[model samples]
Target: MNETLKNNTAAAEVDTRETVLEVKDLVVQYVLKEATVEAVNDISFSLKEGEAIGLVGETGAGKTTTALAILNLVPDPPGVIQQGSISVCGNDMLNLDVKELQKIRGKDIAMIFQDPMTSLNPVLVVGEQIAESVRLHEDVTASQAFDRAIEMLELVGIPGARAHDYPHQFSGGMKQRVVIAIALACNPKILIADEPTTALDVTIQAQVLSMMNDLKEKFNTALVMITHDLGVVAKMCDKVAVMYAGRIIESGTLEDVYNTTLHPYTEGLFNSLPRINNKGSELKPIPGMMPDPTRLPKGCAFAERCKYATERCFEERPASRYVNETHTVACLRYDEPDFHIEGVED
Candidate 1:
């Protein structure tokens, strides 16, 4: 992790621009017959135009739920937005009507789901799917939308002539590229990519990520990338927000969080990453699994797994403490003068 951080030191500088996505006190919950699961608990973060923020955490840390909440796509009946404010390009997402929200989805914010094989319709031609998204969002004829779809396919490195093919006709990597094209066809202001590279091989993952980076720059799109891959975060994001349970435990510029890790969980995350130089060393996985969302602890959710956890960590939840202008961490250790951990900053 240290070597990876050192090598990617130049990846943290995000361009300053007007805020494109602002989420404040966002809380999402799921109600089942058995229990009420708190999926996202009072989390807030903002993204600037043309910026990308990596939401990194273990599975069930609410990364995908956060993305769904932002796009107002949280499944109802079981899932509900208990409270939150999601603003995209100055438009209030939670308060919008169904008609208005529908209008905003493809044009203002688009999503590329994790599995392209399931995301794309198996029966329909890939070009038609992209064209449908374009025609739905923009006032264009079917012919024009098809042309735009072809252009989008070309942009993602898939030949425009291949647009007539079905999902089964393309390879895994190309299918993912088609997903990217559909997300970009509307030229959305924001793109929520949920583990876009999870299904691809290493080489294909690199290609998809490279295309995403190029397309983001071309469209000036703000992105909320939800993934557990730190290497992906280092390469694609300017800032990072480390999530635990349903909350953002630490957030700042990539350098601040990666180089000077503050939270014990954040430190543990970096420690857990396999170092390229240390070939013989065993990887340190975070102890225990994530707490059950339905039965979360009254104190810190990570207290059970954290080695540095004290009595206070089990007794009370910590408030967000600002260690610097750009960095903030939620931990009781920072409040205690006697608490100290090597390789961690206050």
Candidate 2:
């Protein structure tokens, strides 16, 4: 087993709070006639009640696939969860039947998809869409569900009366608000928001993020926020996981991952970002593209692009190791007794 599974499990063991979500050694892939795509590989993490974690990575890093797998929503023909287990509130998610899974989807765990435009139905009024989810999970009449839907709309900062409007009638931000209402209508224990603010303007993005953070606190919901934006992770997440080529290369508290980056891929992400304090400095973007999922390297996927990579890094897959109580990094450099990233203190 990789150290990721062992180290993450050990981290979970130390936490005293109730674990609302746990994913153990998850491996997801897409099998096509052309070639098999390795998406998520042996990733493990757990979330306590009301805590939030950020799945930060570039596109095609399998953030969305991981989220879909948790809800058992991965399309069957092309996609498959070849191994691993997903647990939500002590219920085994992968083994649950469709009917049982349906019960948990909206109530126990809800997802806010990437795009708000395609997520909603234009034909149906926004109120009914939110009401549908409420009706599905709760033992309530249509009128009660509609009432709850209006309450949800109001909670999301939309006028309760606007619930009668169709999705087309609302602006991009408002439509996103409506989508948030639908996801939160059932008061889910866990919420997986997959780039909820991706489509909005900067002003609206802050508004939406603030609103989601407020609602999460109000509902005491554990959140798995998937995004490519490190700024978003810094603002919303208690813990952060940096994924590269379908694996979590580094994970820890926000301060640990952001301030004390251990993995080369994660350091590259930070280096690529524009810094206000360093206005004249050119951005040091990570060189080369992400590895092809179908033709992933047998060793470290980032070895080819990594400036610090040694011959050993290209020949052997690195195992995750603890840098501190909460911080874990998958880098062979950590295995050496005296090795350290040039400027990072011991």
Output the number of the lDDT-best candidate. 2
The models' CA-based lDDT, in order, is 0.90, 0.92
**Per-model TM-score on C-alpha atoms:** 0.93, 0.95
lDDT of 2 by residue, 1-346 (tens): 5886686577676665678999999999999999999999899998998999999999999999999999999999899999999999999999999999999999999999989999999899999999999999999999999999999999999999988899989999999999999999999999999999999999999999999999999999999999999899999999999998889999999999978888988888877878777788677777899999999998899999988899999999998888888899999977788876643222
Question: Looking at candidate 1, what is the lDDT of residue 156?
Answer: 95
For TM-score, the strongest prediction is: 2
User: For residues 1-346, what per-residue lDDT tens digits would candidate 1 score against the true structure?
Assistant: 6974563454445433778899999999999999999999999998988999999998999999999998888899899999989998899999988899999998889999999889999999999999999999888999999999999999999899999999999999999999999989888989999999999999999999999999999889999999999899999999999999999999999998888888889888877877787777677778889999999999999999988898989999987887886799999888877775566322
Q: Report residue 250 deviation for candidate 1 (angstroms).
A: 0.6
Clashing pairs in 1: none
Report the error of model 1 at residue 262, Å: 0.8
The local distance difference test score of model 1 is 0.90
Alpha carbon deviation, residue 233, candidate 1 (Å):
0.2
Model 2 residue runs over 4 Å out of place are: 1-16, 342-346
> In model 1, where is the ten-residue run with the lowest total lDDT?
7-16
